[model samples]
Target: MTTTLHVAIDSKTKKAVVFPLVFSGVILLLMMIFGVVMLLGQGKLIELNPNMFYKIMTIHGTGMIGVSALAGSCIIWYFLKQYVPLNTAVFRLNVYLFLVGVAMVLVGIFAYDFAGAWTFLYPLPAQSGGMWGKTGAALYLGGMLVIGTGFLILLLEAARAIIKQYGSLATSLGWPQILGKEKGFGPPPTVVASTMVCIVDIIALITGAALLSMSLINVFVPSFTIDPLLAKNLTYAFGHVFANSIIYMGVIVVYELLPRYTGRPWKSNKIFLIAWNMSTLFTLIVYPHHLLMDFVMPKWMIVMGQVLSYMNGLPVLVVTAFGALMIVYRSGIKWDVASSFLYLSMFGWVIGVVPAIIDATIVINHVMHNTKWVPGHFHIYMGLGACAMILGFMYYLTRLEGGRIDNKLDYLTLWLYILAFLGLTGSFLFSGKSSAPRRWAEHLPEWIPADMVAAFFGTFVTITFLLFLVRFISYSSNIGSKINQSDDIRPSTHG
Candidate 1:
């Protein structure tokens, strides 16, 4: 007789998440192709109208962030469910709202020709300079609100469930442990991470919803207005934090999988709890760094922004990465697709931090903040770090339940992906070093070569990602099939 086991994420929740993950994966492919097309246009290899370029750029940014968040939510929900009771219907509602909102956003962008970009930045939406009209702006902003409403409800529900189980958010955050009132390891890492995410994202989505509501009103009522500075502050505060939260949520997968893989429990100590708490605070405040370019902001706020940006991701990244290395060292863990990607996420996160720190400095930011350097910074972090964690979970799920087998091609594909992604980000950094301005529709001849190089690498990335999605889809059918019995609730040590 043979025995098979799956990760402890329950079967019903796995079935519930299938559509969202599939939707996320398919949309990711579409967005990547849009990214490559943008690179091609910038490279002079294709003829793309300037307006159309910005429009694609708009959807590219919005779609990527939205879907990544959607995918990241799946990871959080899948694991957190093991620790607490989460309503499957609430999770399903988020996907439904996401789809409806995406349709509205599409109509706004393609049908109505609205291309104000994801951040929109206040008056631009109202005063589009004839690039778009009120209806288009309203649809986009309103769609975002609807999507945010769903997430807000979902998060509130998570918080409710967490509080019900753990007594309170602070307890889940391990405040008692950090304060030394309680001893031993803190709450399970999933609880700590989920608590932090629920708190921060609830605040962020509300802030964004308010901003969207105001912007939506301003779209039709020409007399109504918001201070540009306030709008900028709100925009980055919401955008920066919401986007960064994807990685924070996705990292839960690492905390769970690594321990189970190496058979080393990832116990949360006092310091770990403190670090997560600090991250919660810092992530909320660090958006000021993006506004460092605007001198009108209070001097103290500018200083705080830069200071917080330096400290923003350090606490959590340091602990998590160090813990990962310690877990894998001498553990004799098997080298497989899921574990490999989980480990790679650590490298991506740490490396991504270096460039961000550089850009956060007042002097460097003054020089390089507007260059392709900024894009390069986030691409490494969000692309490699957050995306890797999600991909690891995807692969982990398929393998455990579907019995997906790994071949040399899978490893080969991974290698190609690493090198190719490095190649793409390298071109962006080089172009920035050469002083190429970001968000420009056209590039000069000197910059064209770098764009061409980036496009070449981008092509490979899209192809490789297609392979990843195909692999996931092929095995996705077996997801909830093999893990039905009550005994299957336990996690396998490794695949």
Candidate 2:
């Protein structure tokens, strides 16, 4: 008989992961506030510099993506620690490199006004007209390079740890079990989710790195221009995969934590394993939808994008959403800040997917491609879904050490956050229905009311997050203390 042991995550490692998670949460909050303010300026409610608006837009978009990815990494690392012993040194290194990259990006955007938006689409950075110089472009792209390096290293570390523990990637992803050849521990759902994301993101990062390198070269040698179509494809290919992975990261939180609240175990079954495996492949193939409006794109690629877009959401969203509902339906679960947010995020995921699928349709894409619908769909998923997952994980950690929170206040703030976000995204959808264009620094008089409504709801969101931050700081301090005091209490096991 063999007894398997579950190793404890190191206190130092927990500290490393927690600090970054909280810091990224703060960055995420700030980005949202700034984004809302920028939208207000676009509405012309407040006078703002057009260049400054784009500059803030650049930072807000990149910062939100970066912070979401960082938070997801932390969640994966912390949970992965339970199944496999991780190299703490490598984990810390990832943190240092990521923060350094973030700093460089902030300087490039704020100090020098690198306002090409997050995509840094081909020729835009180099041809900034007069708003930003070559150095700013170089700095921003370089920062992305650094950030990609950190994430690549992090995924590599995760792969190493998973393979070491499970013997092979096949086993880690439960392919053997899916094939009926093996009956191993079958890889927990979190392990399966993390493994899938690691593989996909590694590929995404490589694409990102290749493009950034080319962009940097062009920045210095203006004569060496790349193909705009090739650049756009690679850029969106990387960007779409990277953005999708953020939700997958959040999914692990649902897999690992939601069970605890519902007193159920989310194990690796055939459907679960198959769903994740499909996600890994479809996420890569769905980038073409972003290029549907580009007439130069190959017709076959556009069709592939539409087909894959429909397939990609099927496995994860349907399975996870249904699975979550089953767990909570009559489980007599305790609904706290952490569990409530986690559960509610699934609704965001599903609701957001409806619009995403609609937009992927070829006819719809022709009309709505550049409308506010794009932002509306994205914010619905990421703002409400991914952010909610990260915040829920943070709250879970703080309360892990037997820390108590005010139930009334937590529920109030959660509702406020949800309602405000719905309002904000609703405003976007309504405006988009009226053919409101996106990425405009100024809006027409007809669109003014929509922008103002979105901005108004955004304020409620800001207030809710402010309250969350206070509780986060207060309770997180207890986590550090609890680390020193308790060794047997694994909050991974819900009461």
What residue runs in model 1 are displaced by over 4 Å at the alpha carbon? Answer: 1-5, 483-495
Tens digits of per-residue lDDT, candidate 1, 207-300, equal 9999999999888887889999999999988999899999999999999988776767899998889999999999999899989889999999
lDDT of 2 by residue, 358-441 (tens): 999999989998999999999999978898998888877776752644468888999999999999999999889989998888
The TM-scores, one per candidate, come to 0.96, 0.95
Instruction: Give the Cα-based TM-score of candidate 1 against the true structure.
Output: 0.96
Clashes of each: 0, 0
Distance from true location, Cα of 447 in model 2, Å? 0.7
The C-alpha local distance difference test score for the whole of candidate 2 amounts to 0.85
How does residue 376 of candidate 2 score in lDDT? 94
